[model samples]
Target: MRLLSRPLPAALTIGLVAELLFCWRLTTPHMLVFDEVHYVPAARMLRDLAGPVNIEHPLLGKTLIALGMLIFGDGPLGWRALSTVAATGVVVGVHAMLWQIFRRVRTANIGAVLALLNFTVFIQARIAMLDGFMAAFVVGGLAMLLWAMRSEGGAVWRRWLGGAVLLGLAIGTKWTALPYLGMAGAAFLLVRRRHPDLWPGLPALAGLALLGGAAAATYFATFWPAFLYADQPLTLARLLPFQIDMYHQQTQVLPPHTYQSNWWTWPFDWRPVWYLYEPADGAQRGILMLGNPVVMWGGLVAVIACLIAWARGRDARAGGIALLWIASVAMWALIPKSLGFYYYYYLSSIWLALVIAAAFDHWRDRLRYWDEAFLAASAVLFIHFYPILSAAALRGPQSFHGWMWLKSWI
Candidate 1:
């Protein structure tokens, strides 16, 4: 069979298939699972003009969920429909970024496939949460950034402007995306130094100001719902108190969660968080937030290889991905809050998928069957763990025993 090598067709196929997989019986376990309790209710509040819910984080993610719920009745499928779509967007966006930056159709297709198979995204896609939406926008912004670097004059500036807006949307969805925005600005400066002809006479400061201003404006605009509250006037004075509360809410130490883990242990997948585990009428269901071991472990090797390659000879793509992974993990280290979770690695996992794709391209000729074999193994692991990932009913309590390979996973 001839493979689909065209970027749009390939990406769209990946996205559609993923969405179907995610949406299949999406209403199963017919109750709020994991963070759904937090966001879904918050979305309903926004839809019905109730007071702000989950104000610690920004509102766009919940607003999108609310949009879906408003259209469809507020049920499992309704709250999660937007998440399903955004997760699909992440696949397409990453595929576009890979295709545009490397211009290698084979590599880009493999990258998209790897992303779909990776459980970090796969699990999040099935649930109603902010991480999937944030990841989508990050990929979208990066795709735009890469597209801008390859263009000339007005095209370049337009893509940059669009990229800034998307990144701002990401930040509005979750504050964790801020480091990525800063890294994007740094990357812009580096690329501009090399390709001065892209925007010939534009001052670097002026260009940065434009991008920053656009991003800031985009972020502020997402707060329109907050401004429109009946008693709260649409004035800066009212916004300041909400902003202060939001800041304190995020920084203040909260009661400990059983599943919390430090940033150091995330790459190892040492401790998996159980987002939902409920004993129902007939049987028990679960949604264990975990990464596919094959992808997580194999991708780590690829990350090391990319860093080595970048150090030997400056491979801009490899260097940029490595820096992004580092930045995503590093920001958590500096944050005052002591609690962190595995899901915080969502942004870095995109690079991990890229690392696997790069490894495939790097070693395809040397070891013809390795990439294909790795893909097969990844698919098998995903299937083996699907029951837990999707909150599917277990035959018995012992059903989860074998899958918990790590004691910490229990």
Candidate 2:
């Protein structure tokens, strides 16, 4: 229990356990789920020097998936193993960021645990999808930013550059990372403007250059053929057109599936996509797609609480973290993208953890009975939904109903 007294050790232990849990069902039912079909094939093509095809996403995530294929063969487990690792990386990165922000060992530990208990993170971590990787890179970038904010002089420059590099890596994983980069940059600029005497222009320039260089390197490294065929006889005139075409394809409507839903309904959790397993057979045989009702509902309340706290200037750290979380999720709502799903809330889980951590902090000095009761309740909810989240065999419809607290979940 002494480990709990130190945030870093506690976060590391929690991250390791989360990673193990994510990897456990990595190969269940042994088949492609959702977008894995597109990604797996693209990864296979990556192994061969086949001409670059029109893939909507950036190359880093597919590159990571390709790495898994190279190591474990082009199988379900191989493609998904990396996702489990990335998911764990996210948990670890979030822990580091929280510890840095709150400077409280218990708050950081609670944040990591809340992330583990989040059904969305757990389910997505176990699947062969890009969200987990996206989460990792995003959190990694945030952690570096926090480090930069906390450091001094040359150390600050180094951390700032590292944060920029990770931000590029995050963009490589998903385009959504761009908004976060913009937000972080704006925040940095405001901070710099407030204390120009403390900021170094040369270091800031160097960090920006390093970030741009890393992004360019990673971009071409993954898509070397684009550079090689730049002037070839059969080469496409430019990469931009090909990218546009790919974007169109991804955004366009596709064949009806059980979970395909409109973006408007996603926030309400109207329909969640089932990413894996033999659904036709029985409950125990498949992984059900769902988010934790407690976290999801609690997050909504937290969002409101966060706004009020920020308005009152009470607990600025908690309020600021909550605001960052809300901004990240709000991007999805503003985007014109089609077919958003519950898993898209992966980034929102960070905010969810923040809310839960803030709540714990509020109760920390209260009567022990309240604290014990809340902890016990959270544990029960986590255990109750563990089976469906992990794809463990369930009794039948009864099992599906265990976590399907809302009619919308079906």
Candidate 3:
């Protein structure tokens, strides 16, 4: 009973299990999933040091995918290996960050299980996609930030610098994480408000500026390979124009897509993206991106609870998570993009787990094992949907008939 409440042990166990689940049948179907169609080729091009490809997004994610291809020989395994690792890092990072914030084992454990089974991160990691890497590094950056802000007596600056490096990697992976660079500084100030002895004063302004510079430097530095491999020669002068080009591509309108969904629908899991549903290697395989219903739906209550707690008691920890939950989705609404997709909510899905963890942490004495109940429901949904989520074999092409409960999903 006591062991069940220890954070580190559960974190380690959940991290290990998450890695094992992510690794299982990872190379199945032997085909690229959805955006993998775009990113995988770009990764290969980056690996071969050939012409530019998939330039709409930053190069760091594809570069990491390219590194996997370089090491693993540009096959199914190579394309997805690091993505899986990054997703696993997300799982561990979520658990650890929850512990750092709430200092509760049940909260962290529930959050980890919810993250792994949420189906969003699980499928994202299993494919060669930028979201997994972006989510992983941002979570790492935030976790390190929590540590850096709380730590004392030397090495605090080192921790902050480490967090800055990871935040740079996250933004370099995708502009989706760019907002978090600013949000993390805000988190530092919030943490200081909770405990004044830490940073003590208005040093946050200077710290925030330093963090921005460090993260920005690290972000721009990722463009180094482009000079050698891009479609055109890239100079310091050319890079800014190149980024402007990317922003344009990202905002360009396209024909309506079947899987496209709005930002608000994401929290409800109203529409699911079917990344794969083809007969492959003699078995009908399908992969779906859907959030865990328990977490998706339950998180609404947790988020409200967090806001109420913050309003009444100025519970900065819960308030920070509530703000993060809002910011993750609200940022997408503010982005210049003309279209949106369910996968865009992957970051919000992670925040949902965090909010749930915080809510339970806030109500630990009153709520009792509600955390266990939520984790159980999430795990059940994960297993029930495992076949579709993992590209597991189905009887026929019509296999989606059972999984597509909503017309929107169909």
Candidate 4:
């Protein structure tokens, strides 16, 4: 355990475990689940150079999936392998960011553990989707930003450059990462106010402007693949029009579906998407995107406690977690997508998991091992729900109800 007293080693260990879980029976269902039908084909088109497919999303995610196919062959493994790695990258990035913020290996380990157990990241990783890549780059960018805040002149520039690139990649993977720009700007201003002398050589406003410019340049660069499409490949003049089309597609009115949930209900786990359910792999199986009860329910209380600690007790760690959780979740309210799903809260769920870690870290004096205790409870739920969560064989079709406490889950 003493070996994990450092950040890098602990992050490696946690990431290894996460990768194993994500890769376990990775092709179990052997068919597309949920959005994979849309994305996986697009990936194949990219892989074969057939043409543009699923143009509503940006190219980076599909490019990664196509690259995975090139390396792993066009099968379930290829469709999802890159996403699995990307999702595991999020776990490592969260650990790195936690260490930067909390500077405590134990707290960072707790954050990584919660991330591994969190329901949303796990499911997204095992599927072929854009969100996994976007989430990874988003967390990595934030981690780099934290490092940049504490570094010296040249180091600060290098890290900020890295962060800006990652931010661009995040947005390139999915437009959903745009709100993080606002979040990062607000965070930088607050951090500058708190640590006035840290970025000694750079003016705060100038630094923000530089980061934004670098991020935009990098974002525009991500569209080069669009020019490779055979039919009417985009030119410089058409990029803006292409973006306009994508925007309208994203914001266009669409009919409602059963699994769709409002942004407000996402945090509460009011609706869970059944990614897979039916006979498959020789037995009854299911894969439900339900949030863990302990993390989702307990996390709400932890967030309030962390907010109180930030407001009244002047705890910066609690404040950082609270700020990030809000930034990640709150933007969905403003998104024009009428067809929002529970997975839209994927980024916020990671921060809520961190809130649980930060809250226990703050109250360690009286709480003692309460963090470990609750994590144990959450881990038990992880196991209890493993059959459905991991596509493990069930006793029968009715087995899905064994873990379904609410009718809404159906």
Query: TM-score per candidate, in order?
Result: 0.95, 0.86, 0.95, 0.97
* Model 4: how far residue 137 lies from native, Å: 0.6
lDDT of 2 by residue, 212-279 (tens): 67655654444454454323312446555756766786678756656666654554556776665455
For lDDT, the strongest prediction is 4
- Clash number by candidate, in order: 0, 2, 0, 0
User: What ranges in model 2 sit over 4 Å off?
Assistant: 193-222, 225-237, 250-258, 262-268, 277-284, 362-375, 396-399
- Please provide, for model 1 over 269-289, each residue's C-alpha lDDT reduced to its tens digit, 9 standing for 90 to 100: 888888877775467877788
Clashing pairs in 1: none
List lDDT for all candidates, in order: 0.81, 0.69, 0.85, 0.86
Q: What is the lDDT ranking, best to worst? A: 4, 3, 1, 2
Error of 2 at 244 (Å): 3.2
Tens-place lDDT per residue, model 3, 174-231, is 9989899988887777766667777433377767876898899999999888888646
TM-score quality measure for candidate 2: 0.86
Best by TM-score: 4
Better of 3 and 4 by TM-score: 4
